[model samples]
Target chain A: DAGITQSPRHKVTETGTPVTLRCHQTENHRYMYWYRQDPGHGLRLIHYSYGVKDTDKGEVSDGYSVSRSKTEDFLLTLESATSSQTSVYFCAISSSGGTDTQYFGPGTRLTVL
Target chain B: AQSVTQPDIHITVSEGASLELRCNYSYGATPYLFWYVQSPGQGLQLLLKYFSGDTLVQGIKGFEAEFKRSQSSFNLRKPSVHWSDAAEYFCAVGTTTGNQFYFGTGTSLTVIP
Candidate 1:
């Protein structure tokens, strides 16, 4: 298994509060992605970073932001939490090469009240 | 736009029975396909991927998938089903050049003993 970790394994925040989830990878992968998993909907990409300080928006980037200051750490922040943002968030890392296999972290469960 | 469709939302099968999960994709070109398994409250794990070469691709945990260009499908199959195999399965499609991936809604499998 790839060495990936997600901090704040579980969190509950009231609406309009700020929240940040962290993803750390020991494998030094160049590509890191943040995704949300919800019922009736599969994993949807929220944001991804191709390299340090390089980021891009995904299909569902609204209400979320990401940063990659260092190669090993990627952070996802919700500026203002909403009830629709309540879901399990997963972090994944993969090498820069052609191999598209992504190794995922344990995931963070967030609930907005 | 690239998208994936998993028609079966849920399926039940007896242990030792053959299993199949259907996946259909829509893409302009020959796309990269993948299958992943997710246990309850756990991160997604890659099962198999089809980039090029043989149409039949073998993956971890005794899983295999066949990529059919004519049908635009990448169906997952296993000779025998075990209780451990009961989980949610997602089919993903990606472009050859881009690293972004789109996932299906997923199919929940229940293995009855």
Candidate 2:
């Protein structure tokens, strides 16, 4: 198993509140990704960082933001929580882009009331 | 745009029964495909991936997948399954040059003894 961990495994926040989820990896992988898992929608990419301070938006980037200031840490923030943002978020790491296998962290379950 | 479709939302099978999950993808070029398993409250674990070379790719946990170009399908199969294999399965397609991965809605597997 890859050395990856997500903080705040479970969280509940009221609407219009700010929340931040953290993903930490010991593998020093170059690529890190944030995704949200929802029923009937699978896992949708939120954001990804190729290297320190390099990030890009994914298919479902709205209402979410990410930042990676260091290789080992990637953070996903919900500027203002919404009921629609409630989902299980997963963080993954890969040594290479595209077809390379990605290892995932334990995941964070966030609830917006 | 690249997309993945997993038609079966849920499936139930006997413990010793052979298992197959269907996955079809849409992409302009040869696509990179992958299958991942997710247990309750856990993260996504890579089961198999198809990049190039042999059409049949073997992966962890006694699983295999075949990539068919003509059908635009990459189906997952296992000769025999264990109760531990009961979980949600997702099929994904990777972009040509980015870390982005597009996933299917997912299929929930129920193994009965």
Candidate 3:
């Protein structure tokens, strides 16, 4: 499990509402990533943080933002929730070593009505 | 662009039957490959990874993968399928420099009684 926990394991929100999902890791890893899993899409990277306060956009970064103010916490926020944004969000962390194998959190299922 | 391809969207195998899931990657350089499994309502778990050394890599849950550089494939295989093995499998490729990974659409496996 890599000591990773995601808050709000399940959430339901109305359209136009803002929602934030938090991923916390105890290992103090250097890399943290936010990904959304959907049918036929597998998992798509929304954003990732390589270091504290150092974040970068991923292939599907529109309408989503991430912040890593501290090493142990990474937050993903949806400015305005939409039905299309409903999916399972996962947080993963990888060590600074070159292995590139990531440990994933359980995941958060979000529904936008 | 680096990408992963899982040709089969779904597969069915009888319990105790041998199983193989195909994965092909498109990358320019020597790539880092990985296999992950996701159960219902659960997070993705790392099965195994191939970086270098021997082409055959062993993973958890009685799973193993072989990396074929010539074919750009890292197919996951198991000698006997168990009902517990029913889940979605994903194949991913990472670049040499960055930890970012690209994942396949995933294959859903069904173990028949």
Candidate 4:
């Protein structure tokens, strides 16, 4: 639970539509990350932010954008959703940097048709 | 390139049986290794981690992982399996100075009665 929450626990969207998922954390962790989970893929990093307004692309960041305007909130936006982007999204936070343990929030299941 | 290999995609063990999940990673320098477990419809939870310390690391839920630098492996083991331990286990590797993590495909554990 880690005091993390993801909005839109489940959603079904049409292809080519825009979608945004929100992650809010009460813990003031310095690092936040977005990951997508899929069958056979396990979990892959999509994007991550180390501080407000400082974000970096992950292994699968194409077609996705992220914003971290504040310490407690990180946003993931898909400009135009595709079926391939349909998967479970998870938000994670760590007190320190990458080497530290990460606590994950309940995931958001997105479906694109 | 960094990669994590989890040979077993699924494992079945009876209750009270011993369990071991294999994880191997490819990284140049000293790597940060971690094990995480996920239940149905739940977020990933940290089982244990190995940064630098004793080769054996203890984790939550009576789980332990042995880090073998020689073999580039960090294998998770539990002496007794519980029915509640049926879940998906993932192994991840992170760099000491980076914020990205590479995760394994994950192994699903089934605890049979």
Candidate 5:
């Protein structure tokens, strides 16, 4: 098991509200990623951070934003929640980029009404 | 562009029966492949991964996968099925440079005793 944890394990909120999910890793991994899991679509990458203040968009980066101010914490924020944004979000950490095995966090299930 | 495909949307097998899940990938170069299992309401756990070297890769929980370049496939197999193994499985393809991973739609496994 990796030293990764996600806060607000479960939440439900109305649409058009602001929501932020937090991923914290004690392993001090250099790479952190945010992904959304939906049925029949698998898991889609939302965003990723390689270092502090360095981030990149993923295949499904729309309606979501991420920030990495410290090595241990990466935050994903939905500026305005939408029904389509309801999904289980996962955070993963890797010591090296690509080819290296990534350990995942427990996950956060968010629901937008 | 790199992409992963899981042929079977859902499969059911007897407890003692052998199980195999098909995965095919599309990539220009030698792609990094991985298989992950996710229980209901849980995070994705890495079952195994193939980077290079060995064609057959072994993973945790008595799972193994063979990376066949000729077929562009990385199929997961187990000699005996377990009820606990009933979950969704995802196949992913990644590149050596980009910190990106493309996942398949996922296959749901149902093990019946």
Candidate 6:
């Protein structure tokens, strides 16, 4: 499990509501990432952080934001959740920068009605 | 932009049969390649990765992948398939510029008895 854990393993929310997912890791990895998995989209990067307070948008970062206040925790927020945001969310950590191996967390399944 | 293509959306094979999943990437430079397997409703597990040196990379669970620069491909192969191997497989390409990764849609494997 790579010492990674995601909160709210499964949740159902109403459309237009706010939702936040938490990813916590004990590995002290320098890099952390948020990804979404869908039926035809496979896995798409949502946001990533290289260090505390250092974050960047990914391929599908629109309508979503992230924060990394500490080295062990990265948070993903959907200010206004939409049905399109209903997907499996995964958190990953890497010891180094990109091109390094990433270990993934169990994942959180979110469904927006 | 960078993209990963998994030609086969799904594949079926009998138990104990050889299995191969294709992964092709379009990149200007040599990027790190990886193969991951995800069981139903679970997080992805790293199967193998190719960074440098030998083209053939061995990973956990009796899985291996061949990085063919000539073909711009890194294919995952297993000599014998197990029923437990029936899951979704994803291929990812990582670049050095940023903490970015492009993943293929996925290849759903069905191991029949």
Give me the candidate number with maximum DockQ: 6
Shares of reference contacts reproduced by the candidates, in order, are 0.52, 0.82, 0.59, 0.86, 0.80, 0.79
Off by over 4 Å in 2: none
lDDT tens digits by residue: candidate 4, B1-113:
89999999999999999999999999998899999999999999999999997999999999999999999999999999999999999999987656778899999999999
Residue B35's lDDT within candidate 2 is 97
TM-score of chain B of each: 0.97, 0.97, 0.97, 0.98, 0.97, 0.98
Q: What is the C-alpha lDDT of each candidate?
A: 0.93, 0.93, 0.93, 0.95, 0.93, 0.93
lDDT, residue B80, candidate 6: 99
Question: Which of the numbered candidates is closest to the native, going by highest lDDT?
Answer: 4
**Please, what are the lDDT tens digits per residue for candidate 1 over residues A1-113?**
89999999999999999999999999989999999999999999999989999998988999999999999999999999999999999999988522478888999999999
State the displacement of the C-alpha of residue B32, model 4, in Å, after optimal TM-score superposition: 1.2
Please identify model 4 stretches exceeding 4 Å from their true place: none
Task: Give the winner by DockQ: 1 or 3.
Answer: 3
Colliding residue pairs in candidate 1:
none
Off by over 4 Å in 1: A97-99
User: Which lDDT tens digits does candidate 2 get at residues A1-113?
Assistant: 99999999999999999999999999989999999988999988999999999999998999999999999999999999999999999999988866688899998999999
**lDDT per residue, candidate 5, A32-96, as tens digits?**
99999988889999999889999999999999999999999999999999999999999999888
Residue B107, candidate 5: Cα error in Å is: 0.8
Task: Encode model 4's per-residue lDDT on A30-71: one tens digit a residue.
Answer: 999999999999999999999999999999999999999999
Interface RMSD of each: 2.0, 1.1, 1.8, 1.0, 1.0, 0.8
Model 3: clashing residue pairs?
none
Better of 2 and 6 by lDDT: 6
Cα lDDT of model 5 by residue, B3-100, tens digit: 89999999999998999999999999989999999998888899999999999999999999999999999999999999999999999887776777
Residue B58's lDDT within candidate 6 is 98
Which candidate, 3 or 6, would have the higher TM-score against the true structure? 6
CAPRI band for model 2: high
